[model samples]
Target chain A: MPQQVTRLLIVFAVFIGMFLVAAAFLKPASFGEYGHYRGNAIKEIAAKEIKFVDRKSCANCHNDNSDALAGAEHALINCQTCHGPGYKHNQWFEQNKSRFMRQDPASGIWTVDTILVRAAKDIPEEYKLLKPNERDACLKCHAINAARREKVVRQIDVTDHYDVKKKCVECHPPHAPNS
Target chain B: MDPNYQHLYDALSKVEGYIYPNEIGLNWGILIVLYPYITGLVAGAFILASLNRVFKVKALRPIYEISLLTSFSFLCVATMPLIAHLGQPLRFYEMMITPHLTSAMAIFAFVYLWYLMAVLLLEIWFDYRKDMVIWSGEKKGVLRLIYKVLTLGVYDTSPKSVAVDERLGYIITVVGIPSAFLLHGYVGFIFGSLKANPWWSSVIMPVVFLFSAMVSGIALVLFIYMIISWIRKQKLDMKCLDSIGKFLFYILIFDFVLELLDTVHRVYTAEESFDIISILMTKLFFTLTIGQLLLGTFIPLLVLGYFQFSKPKDAIRKASYFIISILVLGGIFCMRWNVVIGGQLFSKSFMGFTTYKARLLGAEGLLSSIVIMIIPCLILAALLWLLPPWKKKNMEAY
Candidate 1:
C-alpha cells in the first residue's frame, strides 16, 4: 500500500510540475508581450524590414518598370527586396561612362557594348551580387502552399531551376521590369 | 487544346505511369491494405480460439491450443505494418506516451494494447502456465533460464494453481471476444465513418468485417488442424472438422449477405460516384466478382455446405476442408484488396478511374508484409520446440 501510494504521489508530483511549468511558459508566450505582437501585423512587418531603394529614384530612369509595378501582385513589395540597392549600379555608371562614349552609335544600347568592351577590368567579384540559386529572395512573400511552406518551399535548392540560373532578374528584369 | 478535351487530358497527364500518390509513391495504399489485412488475421485468429473457450465446442478442442497460439502470434505482428507506415517510425511511442485522444488513430493504439496485453497475452500465459512450469523444470541450460524468466517466479503447479489458471483463462477468453471483434470491426468503422469516400462509407462495413473475420478464422484453423494432424500421422478429428465446416458455412453466408446488401445499397442510391464504381466492378475488377466472390466465396460455400450436410467419408471431408479453406482465405484477401484499392480507384475529383499495382520489395512493400507474417510462425516454432505439447511423461519438472 505504501509503495503504491508513493508511486501515485510521484506521478502526481510530476504531473503538477509539468502543469505549472507549462502554465508559466504559456501565459507569457501566448498572452503577454510576445503573444501581443504575434497578433499585430504592423509589428510583424516592422520586425522584417525590407532593404528597399526608393522606387521614385528607379522611376526617374525606368518608367516602364513603374508602369509594370502598378499591375503586378508584387506592386506592394518594395524593389530592393528582390534586387539589392542601386548604389552599385550608380558606381558602375560612374566608372564606365568614359568607356561608354567610345561605343559604336549604330549599335543598340552602349550598356551591352560597354560590358563586352570593358569585360576585363579590376571589378570586385563580391560586388557582382547576382545569385540565381537563392529562392528565398523571391519566396519571402509568395507562399503558394502556406501549410508546408517552410518544409517544402523554403528548403528547396533553387539552383535546380536552370531557367532562373542568374537569379529571378533573368526573366524578371528588375530595373526595367516590363522589358 | 479544346476545353473539354483539355480537362480530360490534364487529368490523364497527372496520373503517374507506375508510381502512385506521386508525392509519396505507393506507400500510403500499401500501408492501408496491410493495416486491415493484419488486423483481420488478429480478429480471425481470436475468434477461432473463442469457439472452443466461449462457445464450448468440443470438436474444436484440437485447434483450441493452436488457435490461442495463432492469435497471440498474429497479435504480436499486427502492429508492424502501422509502424512501417509512420512517417517518423521512431516516434511511435508517442501513441502511448502522449496520445491525442481525439484522433481515431490515438484510440486505435489503446484498443490494440487492450487486445494485446490484456486479452491475448494474458490468456496465452494462463493457458500455457502449467506446461511452461513442467518444461522449465526439465530443461538444463539456456532453455531453463528462458523458461524461468517466462514463469516470472510462479512455480506453484498445485491443483489449486491449475484451477485458478483455467478459470482466468476462461474469463479472458470471454473478455477477448468483444476485443477481438473490435480489433477488426473498428478498422471497418474507420473506413465507414469517412463520409468523404463514397466507396468506404457504408453502415454495413463493421458487420461485414466481423462476420468475415469469423469466416477466415474458422477456415485458417481448419487448414492448420489438418496440416498438424497430417504431420503427426494422427487421425483427423471428424467432429472438429464437421463443426468447423458448419461454422464456416454460416459465417460465409452472413458475410456474403452483408456484402451483397452493401453493394445493393450502393447501386440503389446511384450516388455521384456510381458510374466509376460500376466501371470498377464490371471492368476494372472483373476478377474480383467472377473470381473472388463467385468462384471463391459462393462455390466454397456450396462445397462446405454439401460436405457438412452429407457427413462425408474422412478423405472426402479432408479434401473439401482444404479446398474450402483456400477459397475462404483467397476471398478475404480479395475483400481487403477491394476495400483498400477499390476506394482509391475512383478519382478524388469524382472525375474518372485509376489503377493500383502492389510493389514487390519497396520500403513499404510486400517484402515487409511477408517478413512480418513469417516472424510469428518462426516464434511459434521456437515456442513449440521449447515446450513440446506431445510429451509422454506427466512429471512436475518445475
Candidate 2:
C-alpha cells in the first residue's frame, strides 16, 4: 500500500476496533442470549412483587367496606385502582394491627394513628392508599371526550354536570355508587 | 405545579377544541421542527457542493469549499435539537448502542456518523490537506499548532499525492450525493412512516423532503455567498450567483409541486382524516399558506424566473438574488414547521384540534430553538476564521 493509503486503513481499522470493543462490553448481561432482546428481562419482570392487593384480602378485615362495594357499580373495579397500590397498605395494616386496637381487649373501638390523616393528602408514599375527593379525580375517566366511547365509559359532560362547586364524592357514595 | 409546564397550561386553556389531556402538551415542540430543517440544510448544502466536484460544473467552483464548510458547520449542530428535545439526553448513546433494529429513528445515529466521518470529513480533509500543511509551516504560535494538528502529520504536497487526493475526493463526493439524499430522505421517513398519523404518513414524503432540502440548501449558500463578498469588499461573482439562483428556483418548484400533489391527493380522496386536516389547514393558514407558499415558493420562483430571461443590471440582479435567497430559506423552514407542528395541531380522534404557541423560555421553547439555529452560524463563523476559503496571497505556491 502507498504511505497515505496505509494511514487511512489504520484509521479505519482503529474505528472498527473501537466499535467492536464497545459492542462487546457495553451490552446488558442477558442481551442476545435468546433473540435480539435481553433474555433475562422476562424473568426479571415476572419476579416483581404484586402491588395491587385484590378484593379477597381486603374482605378479610373490612367486611362493611367490602359489603358497600359488592354489587355496586364499582363491584368489578379493583379497590387499589382509585386508592393507589395496596401492597404497602395491606402490609402496614397487617404488621401494625395492634396499633389500631384499644388497650382493653374487650373494647372493640378503633382509631387511626394521630400522626397519619393529619392533612388532606396525609397518606405517605410508603403506604400507597389515598382518599381522592377532587372533581378531576372523577372527571379523568368520566369527562366527555371524542376519544372515549359512551359504551366503554359512562362519559359525563363536565360543563353540564350538576354543580361544578360540588365533587362527585359529595353526591354519590364512592364505594356504592347507586346514583 | 411544575413551573416548566406553565406554558403548556397556558396553551391548554386557549385550546379551541377538546384534546386528550396527554395531547395538551405537544411532545414534539419547535426544537423538533429545527431538527429536520438543519439536517435538510446539510443534505442540500452537500449536494450543492458535490455539483462542482463530481458533475464538474465549473460555475459552482467558486462556492465549493464554502458550501462544504456550511454543510459541515450545520451538520455539527444538527443533532443538538434532537438531543435537547430528548427527555433524557444522557442516555442518547443508547440510540447509538443496542438500537432497536426495526425503528427508523434508531438508524439516525449511524447515518449521521457515516455522513460525518466517512463522507464529509474525508472529502474535506483530502481537499484541504495540502493547504493545511503549507499554512502550518508559514504560521507561528497557537495558530501554527492548530494547522499542524489539522494536517495529521501528512506533509505530502507532491504531484502524485495531489492526484490521489483529487481522485479520492471525487469518489467521496459521488458517494456523498446519495448519502446526502439518504440523510434528509430518512429525516422525512421519521415522520412519513407513521401509519397512525394521517398528516405525516405519505408515499412521497422522503422525495418531498429531499427536494425541499435542495431548495433550502442552495438558497442558504447563495445568501451566504452574497454576504461574504460584501464583507470582503470583493466584487460579487455574478455567474456563480446566477447559476445558484437558477438551481434554487428549479428545486423550489419541484418541492412545491410535491407538497401540492400530497395535499391534492388528500383533498380528492376525502379520507376520514380529511375533516381534521382541513381544520388544521385553517389553523396553520399563516405558516403554510403565507410563509411557505407566498414568501418561500412563489416570490423566489418569480424573481429567479424573471432573471432567467431578462438581463437586468448587475446591481438589480444581485439585490433580487439576495432577497430571493432569504425568502426561499424562510419558506423551507416554514415547510418543516408545517409538517412537524401542523401534524400535531389536531387530535388523533379527528374530532378536535389543539394549538401550539411556542414560548420564549425553557429548553423546549422558541428561544432555545432560535439559539439552536444561531449555533450553526456561530460555528460557520469560527470555521471561516480558521480556514478562510478566499484566494490567498501565495496563489501558485503549491
Candidate 3:
C-alpha cells in the first residue's frame, strides 16, 4: 500500500511538471518591444467606448432648439456639431457683442437665423448634403427611436431608410428657435 | 399575422429592413450558432470513444477507430465555419496569437489547441502506429509514401511495441474525455454569459448542449457503424448496437426533459421578454417544437427503447436502429438550429424579425459548408485504407 501511494504521488507530480513545461514552451510567440503590460494597456484603450454628449447642454443657449429638434425626432442628439461648438460660439458672441440678427436686444448679438446658417455649415458633409425634403439627416441616428422618428419623415423609402436618408437636419433647423 | 405584429411592422418600416449601428452584423450570431454544432460533434465522438475505452463495450469495437477519426475530422472543420463568419477572417489568428486570457473565448482557443495536439492527434497516432508499420512495406506509389510519412519513420511491429502503443493510447483516451466535455460545454457558457440577450441567458444551456451532443454522437456512430458493416459485408453486432441504442435513449430523454424544463420555467416566470418569446414559439418555432421535439425526439426514443428492451432479431433490429439513428440526428440538428438561428431571427426590439438565407456557393454559402462536412469523411476513408482495421493482426485481441 505504501509503495502504491508513493508511486501515485510521483506520477501525479510528473504529470503536473509536464503540463507546466508544455504551457511555458507553447506560450504564443509575440513581436517587438510592445510586450505584456504595454500590449494590454493599448488593448484597454482600444476597447474604451467613444462617448456621445447628451442633448441637454445645447438647450441652455437655444431654448427653442429642443422643441425644433423634438419635432424632427432628434431630441436625443447633442448640439455640439450642429450648433458649431456652443461654448466657443457663445464666447465669441459674448465678447464681440455683435447685434446681427439678434432675437432680443439685451440677448447676445447673434439672432436665431444667423446661428442656424452657421450651425448648418458646420455639419458633416454627408448629413449636410442630404436632400432638403428627405429626412436622411434626421433619421440616421434616430431611426431606431421609432416613436421620435415618426414625427419627422413619418415614412421613408426602403433603400433610403436603410441608408443615408436618416441624418439629423432633414426635418429640423440646425440652430433656429423652435416654432 | 397577429394584430400585435402591426407594431413590429411599423417599427420595421423605419429601418427599412436594415440592422442598427451597422456594427452588429450576422457574423456574431452566425459564429454563436456554429459553436454549438462543432462542440456537439466533439462531445458525441468522445462519448463514442469512451464506450469502448472506459466501459469496455466490446460490440462497439468496430467503431473504435472511426469515432476517434470522426472526432479528429470534425475538429479540423469546426473552426472553418467560425472563420467564414468573421468580418475579418485574416485577423482571426490574433484570437489565438494574442489571446485575451480573461475572456472565455480565449480560454476556448487554448482548449482547442490542447485537444487537437494533446488529445486527438496523439491518441490517434498511438492507436494507428501499429497498423502503419504493417502497411509501410506492402503498398507502393502514393499509398506507400503516405504510409511511410504517417508512421513517423517507425518500422517496429514487435509485440512489445504494440503493447506500449496500446497502453499510451489508453492513457490518452482517459485524458481526452474531459477535453471533449469542455469543447461542447463551453459553447453553452458562451450563450449563457450574454445577460443582455434574455433569449440566451440560462444556466441550463451547457447541460442541455452536453446531453444533446451525446445523443447526436451516439446516433451518428450507430448510423455509420451500420453503413460500414453493410459496405464490408461484415456480420452485424446486434448486441453492441443495442447497447448503443440504450445509451442514446437515455441521453435523448435527458435532453428532452431539460428542454421542457427550460421552456416551462420561462413560461411560468413570464420574464420581460416572455411575450415576444411566446410569439416566437407560436410562430417561427412551431415547426421545430412539433416536428423536432414531439416527432423526431420522442418517437425515435420510443422506437429505440422498444427495440433495445424487446430484444428483436438481427435484421429487424438493424432496420429499426438505422431509422432511429437518423431520427436522432435530425432531432439534435433541430435543437441546434433552434438554439442558434432562432435566437437571432428576432430583433432586439422583440417586435420584428429578420430573415437569413444561406447562400449556395462562395463564401458563407451552403456549398462551402457541405464541402467542409464531407472532407472529414474522405479523410476517415483514407485512414481506414491505411490502417486496415479489419485484419486479425491489427485487432486489439481482448
Candidate 4:
C-alpha cells in the first residue's frame, strides 16, 4: 500500500473508533433494550397518576346530573371530557371533607353537605374546569360541520340554526340538550 | 348560554371556516420555512460546483471552489432549525440510531448524513488536501499546525497522486449532482407525500424544488461572487455574471411554469378542496402574487431577458445582475414560505384558516432565524480564511 493511503486508513479508523466510543456512552440506558425506542418510556408514563376523574366518580356525587345525561345524546361521554380534569377537585374535597359534613337535626343523622358538593361550578383554579356555557366547550362536540358524518349525529351550522354569537346551551341544557 | 359566557364565544368567532380543532394552531412556523430555504441553498451551491467540476463549464470555474465552500458552510447549519423545532432536541440522535422506514421524517437523518459525510466532506478533502500539505510547509505558528493536521499526514503532492486526487474529486462531483437533487428533492417529498394537504401533494413538487434550487443557488453564487470581487478591488467577470443571469432566467421560467401548472390543475379539477384552496390563494395574494410571481419572478425575468438581447454598459449590467439576484433569492424564499407555511394555513378539513405570527424572540422566532441566517455567513468567512479557496501565489507551491 502507498504511504499516503496507509495514513488515510489510519485517520479513517481513528474517526470510526471515536464515533463508536461516543455512541456507546451517549446512547440512552434503555434504548434498544426491547425495541428501537427507550423501553423505560413505557414505565415512566405508567408511573404517572391518572389525572382525569372517571365518570363513576362524578356520578357518585351528582346522580341527578348523571341520570339527566344517561339516555341523552352524551350518555357515553366522560364528565371530564368537557368539564376538564377533576383530579384536583377530588383532592380538594378529600382535604375539606370535615367542612362538608354535619349532623342533620331533623333526622338526627350525619349527612354530606349537598350544596358544597353540587356547586362544581365553584371549583378552585387548579382544577382547570371549563366554564359552563362556554361556546368552545360545546362546539368541540356539538358544532355542526361537513367533516362530521351525516349519520353519526345531527350537525348544525351555527349561523343557519341561530345567531352565530349565540351559544348552544342558551336554548338546550348540556345534560339534556334535546329537551 | 348565559350572557356572561359571551367573552368566550367572541374568541371562538375568529375562525372563519371549518378547521380541525387541533389545526387551529399553525404547528409549522417561520423556522420550518427557514429549514427548506437553507437546505435549498446548500443543494443549489453544490449543483453550481458540479457545473464547473463535472460539466466543465469554463465560465463558471471562478466560482467552483467558493461555491463548494458555500455549500459546506450552509450544510453545517442546515439542520439547526429542524433540531431546534423539535420538542425534544436532545433525542434528535434517535432518528439516526433507530430509523422507521415507513416515516418520511426518518429518512432525513440518513440523507443528511450521507450527503455531508460521503459527498460534500469527501469531495472538499480531496480537493484541498494538496493545498493543505503545501501550506503546512510554507506557513508557521498556529495556522501551520492547523494545515498540518488537515493534511492528515498525506504529504505526497506528486503529479501522479494529484492526478488521482483530481480523478476522485471529479467522480464525487458526478455523484454529488444527484445527491444535491436528492437533498432538496427530499425536502419537497416530505411535503409532497402528504396526501392530506392539497397545496403540497403535487407530483411536480420535487421537480419544482430541484429547478428552484438551481435558480436560487445560481443567483446566490453570482451575487456573492460579484460582492466579493468588488470588495477585493478585482474586476467583475462580466461573462460569468451574464452566463449566470441567463441560467437564472431560464430556470426561473421553468420553476414558475411548474407552479402555474399545479395551480391550473387544481383549478380545473375543482376537487372538494378547490374552493378552500382558491380562498387560500386569495388569502396569500400578496405573497404568492405580488412578492413571488410578479416582483420575484416576472420582473427579474424581463430585466434579464432585455439584458440578454441588448448590450448594456458594464456598470449597468452589474447593478442589474446584483438587484435581480437579490429579487430571485427573495422570490425563492417566498416560494418556500408558501409551500411550508401555506400548506398548514388551511385546516385539513378544508374549511378554515389560521395565521402564523412569527415572534421576534424565543426558540422558533424571527430573532432565532436571523441568527441562524448569520451563522452560515460567519462559517463561510472562517472557512475562507482557513482554506482561502481563491487562487493565491502560495497555493502554486503544492
Candidate 5:
C-alpha cells in the first residue's frame, strides 16, 4: 500500500479501536452469558420489590371477605385486581399501623401478632391504593365490543342492560354477585 | 387527548373490518419510506459514478465526481430517519454496540458503515488526494487548512503516485459497484424477507429495488447536474444528459418489468393472501398507479426512447430531461411509500384494511421527512464548494 493508503488504514484502524472500546464499556455486564440478552437481568427482576403479593396475605385479615369472595361468582378474581397491588397496602399499614390500631392492655399476655385495619378515612391518600367502584373496574372486562369475544369475556351492553346512571354494584355486589 | 395518540384515535374511527387492536396506527410511517428512498439514491449515485471509472464511459465523466459527492452526501444523511424514528433516540447506538447478527434491521448498521467507510469514503479520498495536495497550496485561509488536512501529509504528486491513485480508485469503484448493489438490494431484501406480509414478501423484490435505486439515483444526479450547471451559467453538456436519460430509460424498464412480474405472479397464483393484497392495490391506486407507474416510469421511457430515435432540439431535450428526472425521482419516492405503507394497510388476517394519514409535523411526519431530504442537498452544496468537480476548476488546479 502507498503511504496515503496506509494513513487511511490508520484512520480505519482507529475507528475499529473506538468500536472495541465502546463494546468493552457500553455493553451490559451480563450480556451474552447465556444468550443475546442480559442473563443477570432475570435475577435483577426477581430481586425487585413485590407490588402484588399472594391473596393468602389479604385473606389473613379479611376472613369474611375472603369467604364471600370464595363462595361468590368472583372466586377467580383476587383482592388486588380491584383494590390495586396489596403489597403497597401491606407496607403502608405496617408503617402506620399505630394510627389504626394498638394492642389492648386488657388482653395482657395473649396479644395478637397483627391488627386489622377497618376505617377508610384513617389511611393516607397516597397510601390509599385503589378502591375501584361501579364502572371503573367492572366495565374494563365487561364492556361490549366487536373484538372482545363472548367466550373470552362476558360483554355487557351498558346502554341496553339498565339505566345508564345506575351503578352495577347496586344490583350486583361484586364480592357475591351470583347470590 | 394526548397529541401522541391522536392519530391512532383518528385511525380508530376509520378502521374497517377486523384488524388487530395493535394494528390501529402505522408503526413504520413516512420516515421509514424516506429511509429506503434515500439509501437507494446513495447506492444509485455511486453506481452512476462507477459507470465513468469502471466501465470507462466517456460521456458520464462530466457528472462522475458529482455523482460520487451526491452519493457521499446522501449516504452521510441516510441513517438520520432510521435513527430519529427510534423511540429512544439516545440509545440508538445500542444497535452498533450490541447489534444482533440474526436481525436484518440490525445488520443495516454494519452494511451502512461498510459502504460509507470502506467503499464510498475510500474511493472519494483516493480520487481527491492529488487534488487536495494541489489545492492546499493554491488556496488560502480555512479552505487551505481544510485541503492541507485532507492531504494527510502526503504531498507526492509524481506521475507514478498519480497513476497509483487512479489505479486504486478504479479498483475501489469496481469494488463499490457490488457494495452499491448490496446497499440497496439489501434494503429490498429486508422488505422481501418478511414472510408475514404478502404484499412485501417476494423473491423479485431485491432486483426491483436495485433497478429502481439505479433509476432514482441516476435521475437525482441528472437533476442536480442540470440545476448546478444552469445556476453556474455553464453550457449544459447535452451528450452527458442524453447518456443519463438513455441509461435511466433502460434500467427503469427493467425495474417496471420486475415489479410487474411480482404483481402478475401474485395475481396469477391468487394465493390465500391474494384478496387482501388486491384490496391493498386499490387503496394505493393514486400513489402506485398514477405517480410511480404512469408518471415516473412509463412517460420517462416514452420520451427518453423518443430521444434515441431522433435528435430533438437541445433546449427541448434539456427541458424534457429535467421534467423526466423530477417525475422519475417523485415516482421512486411513491414506490417506496407503496412498499412500506401499502404493505401495512391491510391486516395479516386477510380481512380488514387500515388507514394511514401522514402527520404534518412531529419526528416521523412529512415535515421531518422534507427537512431530512433538504439536508442532503445542503451537504451536497457544501461538498461541491470544497471539492469542485468543474472541468475548468480541475484544469486550473492541475
Candidate 6:
C-alpha cells in the first residue's frame, strides 16, 4: 500500500511535470507582453493598410453631389453609404486621367478604364454602389419597422405605400430624397 | 448601377418582415448545436456511473466502468466544436488565461477544465488504477508496458489499499454528480442568460438542459452496452438493461414535461416576440413537432412506459430497448437543435425570420459535424481495446 501510494505520487508528478512543460512551450512568447491576450495581434492589426477612405476625400471630386447630400435629411449618411468605397475609384482616376480626356462622344469611343466607373455589378455585395434609380437602396434605411429603429424620420411599408414595382426615385430624387 | 447588381436588390426582396441587416447571417450553426449535445453526453454518462458507485445500484454494476470511460471519451472531444466555431480558434486560450467575470462565455473554460481535469479524469484514474496494476503484471509486450505506465507505479493490490481506493472513488463520484450538473447546467446558462434573445431567455433552460442531458447520456450508454454485449455473444444482463431502461423512462418523462412547460409558458405569455416565435415554430414544425416531440420523445416514452408495465421476453425487451434508445438519443439531439438553431431563426427585433442553411462543407458544416460525432465512438473503441471493461469471467473466456 505504501509503495503503491509512492508510485501514484510519482505518476501524478510526471503528469503534472509534462503538462507544465507543454504549457510553457505552447504559450505564445508575447502572451503577457500586453496583458492577457497575445500582444502581437495589436501589432498585426496596426500594420495593415487602412481600407475605408473617409467621406472628406469623396467631397474633393464630386462636390456637387456632396453638397446635395449634405442639404438633405440623409445628411448624416456618409457618401460611401450609396457610392460605395471611393479609395479604389479615386486610385483608378489618379492612375488613368489621360484615358478620360481621350473619349470621343460622336464615335462612341471612350478609352476610360472600366474600373474607374465603380460598376455596381463588379463589386461585392458589401461594397456595391447603389444607382440613383434603385428604390431598395432608399428602402434599406426607410423601410418601416417601429420595432427596430428608435427615431424613424419617415417609414414606408413598401407593399402598402405605392405600386409594388415603382421605384422611389420615380417620385423622390436620390440626392435630396425627401425634397 | 450595373445591371448585374440587380441580384443584390432581389436578395432583400424575399424578406417578408424587417430583420436587422447584420442578423441575416446566423453566427451559430450546426457546430453550436453539437456543443451542448456532446457536453450533455459527458454529463449524462458520468451521472450513470454515479448511479452504481454512489447510489450502490447493484444492477448497474456492469456498465459502471464503461459509463466512466464513455464520459471521459466524449468529454475529451466535447470542446472541439466550440473551439472550431470561434472566429479565431488560435485565440481560444485567451478565454482561459484572461477570463472576463461578467461574460457567461468566459465561465465555460473554467467549468469545463474543472469537470475534465478534477472530476472526470481523476475519478477515472482512481477507479482504473487497481485494475491497471493487476493487468500490468498479467500481460506481456506492448500491452504490458502500456498497463504498467497507466498504473502510475501503484502496484498495490492489498485489501487495505483497495479499500482506500474504493473510498476515494466514492468521494470523487459524489463530487462528480454536482460537477456533472454544473458542467451542462453552465452550458444552458450561456444561452439562457442572453436577455437579448427571447427564445433562450428563460430560467427553466438549465433544468431542461440537465434533464435532457441525463436522458441522452443514459440512452447512449444503454445502446452501447447492448450492442457490445451482442457483439461479444455474451448474455445480456436483463436486470441491468431493465434498470437502465427504467431510469431512462423516468428521465425522459421529466425532460418531456419541462420542454412542454417551457413551450406553454412562452405561448401563454404572448410577449412581443410571441407572434414572430409562433411563425418560426410553424416553419420548424417538421424538426420540432414531428422529429423532436413526436418521434424522439413521445413515441419512445410510450414504448418504454409499456415495457415498464408489461413483462416481455428477453429478446423482445432488448429489441424494444435498442430502438427506444436510438429514438431517445435522436429526441435529445433534436431538443438541442431546437434550442441552438431554432433560437437564432427569429430576428431579435421580433419582426422577422431567417433560415439556417447548414453547409455540407467548411469548418462548421455537416461533414465536420458527422466527423466530430464519429471521433468519440472511435476513441471509445480505442479505450475499450486498451482497457476492456468486462467481468473477470468474460475477460478470461474472451
Which candidate's TM-score is highest? 5
lDDT of 5 at B94: 86
Q: Tell me which of candidates 2 and 6 scores higher on TM-score.
A: 2
Q: Judged by DockQ, which candidate is best? A: 5
Alpha-carbon lDDT, every model:
0.69, 0.83, 0.67, 0.82, 0.86, 0.81
Q: Which pairs in model 3 have colliding backbones? A: A98-A109, A136-A165, A136-A166, A136-A167, A137-A167, A137-A168, A138-A167, A138-A168, A139-A166, A140-A166
Ten residues in sequence with the least summed lDDT for candidate 3 chain A:
A125-134
Which ranges of candidate 3 are over 4 A from the true structure?
Answer: A1-178, B1-32, B347-362, B396-398
Alpha-carbon runs more than 4 Å astray in model 5: A38-47, A55-81, A92-124, A142-146, A154-162, A172-179, B1-11, B391-398
Better of 2 and 6 by DockQ: 2
Q: lDDT per residue, candidate 4, A72-175, as tens digits?
A: 98787788877778877777777767777878889989766767677646556785456568665676555554335557766665446677677778888888
Candidate number achieving the greatest lDDT relative to the actual structure: 5
Chain B alone vs. reference chain B, TM-score for every model: 0.89, 0.95, 0.88, 0.95, 0.96, 0.95
Model 5: lDDT of residue B227 = 94
- Residue-wise lDDT of candidate 3 within B1-398, one digit each (tens)? 22444454554553423344231234444444555776687679777887798779887787787788778877887777777777798766666645677888767877787888778887887787767767777778888898788776666767776777787788888888887887788878887787767778899988888888888888877887788878888877776788788888888889889988999999999988897677666654544876577666878878877865687677888898898888877777777777776676656766555555565866677776677667767867766665656753656441
Q: Which of candidates 1 and 4 is the stronger one according to lDDT?
A: 4
Position B379, candidate 5: lDDT? 97
User: Candidate 2: which stretches are off by over 4 Å?
Assistant: A22-25, A28-30, A33-50, A96-128, A132-170, B1-12, B392-398
lDDT by residue for model 5 (A1-179), tens? 78877887888789999999988899999888998989999899999988987888787656668899986778898888888888877777667655655566786553323444654457677666676675636776676544446786677865467776777888888888878
Better of 3 and 6 by lDDT: 6
How does candidate 3 score on lDDT? 0.67
Candidate 4 residue-wise lDDT at B32: 93
Give the per-residue lDDT of model 6 (tens digit) for B77-191: 9999999998999888767655667778888888998898778877877777778888888889999999888776678778888778778778888999999999999999888
Alpha-carbon RMSD, candidate 4: 5.6
lDDT of 6 by residue, A1-179 (tens): 46555765676688779867767777778876867668998999998866567787676556667789886977898877777666666665555455544466799785544344433244344443445466667766676543355465577775568876778878887778777
Cα lDDT, model 4, residue B81? 96
Per-residue lDDT of B238 in model 2: 85
Whose lDDT is higher: candidate 3's or candidate 4's? 4
Kindly report the interface RMSD of candidate 3, rounded to 1 decimal.
11.5
DockQ agreement of candidate 5 with the native complex: 0.37
